[model samples]
Target: MDAGLTPVRVVGAGPVGAVCALALAQQGVPVCVLEAQPETARGDSRTLALAQGSRLILERLGVWSRLADVTPITRIHISQRGALGVTRLDAGDLNVPALGYVLSYAELAAALKQALRDADVAVEYGIAVARIGASAAAAELATADGRTLATPLAVVADGGRGDDAPQPRFERDYDQMAVVCDVQTELPHAGQAFERFTPDGPAALLPKGDRYALVWTAARADAERIAALPDTAFLTALQAHFGGRRGRFLEAGPRKTFPLKLTWTGSEAGNRVVRIGNAAQTLHPVAGQGFNIGLRDAWELAALAGDTPADALGGAAMLAAYARGRRADVVGGLGFTDFLVRTFSNDLGPLRHARGLGLLALEAFPPAKRFVARRMMFGANG
Candidate 1:
């Protein structure tokens, strides 16, 4: 079979899947996207923190300019509550225009959808896959509507939440939940973000348009209590937990909570069937590595596909190569997030002191700080 004549079937039309499809289409690889949700599905209100590297990828795909209300992160302040050590990362020091950008997930999804249409990529909405399997010849998919399809390659980016999703080879329950909402602070953000590590968990505030998007991590029970608090009480609890760094949290939007965990499918999967984004691995949202890693996964896969000969698009060798190339970034991201969650989300006296010293050491060393900052902006390679 001529691989060029067989379009790649991308499952899930979310940001990660859309990126992979757009990149593939731009590389002249025939591609089509299948989204289970209808075109009129409600927009996602979740906010996203995109690193500069992701910005470059979207720019290359010609979708960056289409986004709206994106707020740049000029600086990030990281510290441990009730500790003596603190460290800050400045975009100016790093010589980057901005470390990252914050925007609603819906905005990014809309831009990618529009870009797909402009690139002439075929997208089938409201088509839920009943099963996705792989064979030496091709990747096969069965839809709920009794339709069957086969392609040289199939990309899964549905976040592994579907009934047919693959079971994760590795999983860890953190027993923590994050209370998230948009908050108005007494003081202006001015593009400054905060990562305050507490004994319970890490609390993060990303600068959004004229406000901040808060992800306050705590024990499951505590998070539920916080999320259920009335608006005024919620703001007061937030101020108490996060401190006066941004002054009192004046107002808060609707609060939501999600459990935190680390799940990975490993590098190896079915032949010619690749998983990207949350479909492959979902990590704790401590350092915001999971989503960016997913973007890198999509970008690199598309690049490698473009380089490989059409006849070997999803051959065993190609899959092996893809796995090898992504190992470092994937493992690095997983390890980094896991380490932060375990190491900092505690209150052992000795460990707390050690963490404080570590922060102080990192702050004193310019090169080390830059290295970590770049890794956050890029990946392990950076």
Candidate 2:
């Protein structure tokens, strides 16, 4: 069969899968993407914060130039709710153009969709992977529509949870739901971001153009209550929790809620099958780490085909090298998000004071601030 006819299959056409397909197509490797959502389906309204490092990778894949309506993040402010702990990071201090950028899901999806068209990467809409079967030669993708696709490599980027997964994954339900929405502040964001940790959970307001995209992570009960709030009441409550740092919360758009959890495979999937993106790992919205790490996953996986023949795409050698190259990053990203969630969601007296002092120290000490800022801008290695 022609390689284009049996292209490496990418399950789930979300950012990760789309990036994977495009990266391969850019390298003259054929790819087919299976998207569960229909062409006309509405995108989730949540906004994502793309780190500086991710921008470079996207540029390499030729996706960044296609993005529209992005809001840059030049500085970040961090604090504990109603506490003296405060730390600020500026792009100038780090000597970078911007720390990050905020983008709506719809804008990003549209960009990737267009890129897919330009690259002529085949995408089958409304086709979800119901199950996967692996063999010595190819990975079998069983679709919900009762069709089967056989390909040398199968990359699963759908958010985890499948009985058909090749290996066991550790799961942690935070018992939290994130309330996402857009809000108008009395003061312009000026490309600044704020993350305030309440005893309940973490709340982050990222600059989105002139407004702010609010991601409020709270306990399930609290999230439900917050979601049920009337517009006037919601604004008041948000103002109280976030304080007046960004001035008053003038108005808000519609709000949505999504449960928070961390699901990650304990090890790599078996031969000829690989999982990347949320299928391999899902993180809390603590530091906006999930998609960035997933994008890197897509890029690394694409690099495996550099000088190798098409027949060996998912052969033992390729899969082994991929696992070795990715394990450290997977471990590091998981540890990074988990630590932020635990450290900030507590209110114990000693720990509270320690965190406050730590924040003070972070601001006072340039080296420590640079270390944390670098990690945020890049990854664990920074």
Candidate 3:
């Protein structure tokens, strides 16, 4: 290692990367964060339904308190468009304060960034990692700025196609678009979130202060058409599709749309390098599993890294243990979400009934419901 070298270097400044950096810094580890963009870029384009388990992780890292403008999800109500079954999970039944929370992406990113600054962690902004080269002893990150950062260990949190990709990724276009926006409803959300499965796809309404942040997934062509509708027409159409569960959607803000996809890869940790967050895998948005899983990845990696000897920051044994520890949760999260999207997205009559019955069964079986909630809350182990 070079004299006075940083112990760890993390790429990407998104919530996952920021939280990962904060975890290490909280452990008194010397680390630096590199962001592709300069400063913190705040956005209101999307909202995240953070699981109860994720709040615990963020709280442990001291970033949770920094977040504001979030609304607790007291319950999660699940139902199908034409089905008679309905399943609802209540936080009170589980003796928890909340099942989840609706957080705007900007709120989370800002909180983590602020926590990073307070910890005196160094963050190099506007520097993108163009390439990463690893050896048994050390790792080097080459940047788009024609500069290089050599460190004892490197954690890649940046997500995208790259030269040294970790595993073979499987991707599906899903032929869907997730149209997102915020709206005011005639009926209050009352801290409850709803997941309604339609013939075309799934739509979610999450409590966001006085409004509900709507993530309505639809077939690609339908999404384009819906997105192009005027605000009044769109809200009316949304109410028609979602039914009168929330009475009616009175008004809607501007909307945005993005193609939905299932892009996932395998886990890897070796040669003085590790990957976490979106760099590891990106799952379908159903069930809101991707970010929660990524948060666990960051937390687990930090715990392992915090316990390692400085001399073995990225040594084989340490890297191996990290890889082993994350395998179950990462694989489990990927499998769970993949299975869910495949099963529920189908509109066939038998499959539809099966899915509805599955929800009904989930409600009838307490143990089963608890098990699923725990898994969603705490990942593989829960």
TM-score of 2: 0.95
Tell me each candidate's TM-score.
0.98, 0.95, 0.95
Report the C-alpha lDDT of model 2 over 184-296, residue by residue, as the tens digit: 99999999999998888999999997799999999998898898899999999999989998889999999999898887773253468888888888899888888888888
Between 2 and 3, whose lDDT is larger? 2
How does model 3 score by TM-score? Answer: 0.95
Question: Tens digits of per-residue lDDT for model 1 on 83-162?
Answer: 88999999999999999999999888888888988898999999998898788999889988898899888888888766
What lDDT tens digits, residue by residue, belong to model 3 across residues 1-382?
Answer: 2237565999887888888888887776788888988884674578898998899998898888878788999999999898777889999999999988898998888888788888888899888888899887688999999988888888888864456675546776688889999999998889999999887888999999999999999999899889889988998899888999889789888889987777766545668777787777887777888889889888888888889888888888888898888888888887888787777877798998888889989999988998888888888888
- In order, the Cα lDDT scores of the candidates are 0.90, 0.85, 0.84
Q: Tell me which of candidates 1 and 3 scores higher on TM-score.
A: 1
lDDT of 2: 0.85
Q: Which scores better on lDDT, 1 or 3?
A: 1
Q: How well does model 1 score by local distance difference test?
A: 0.90
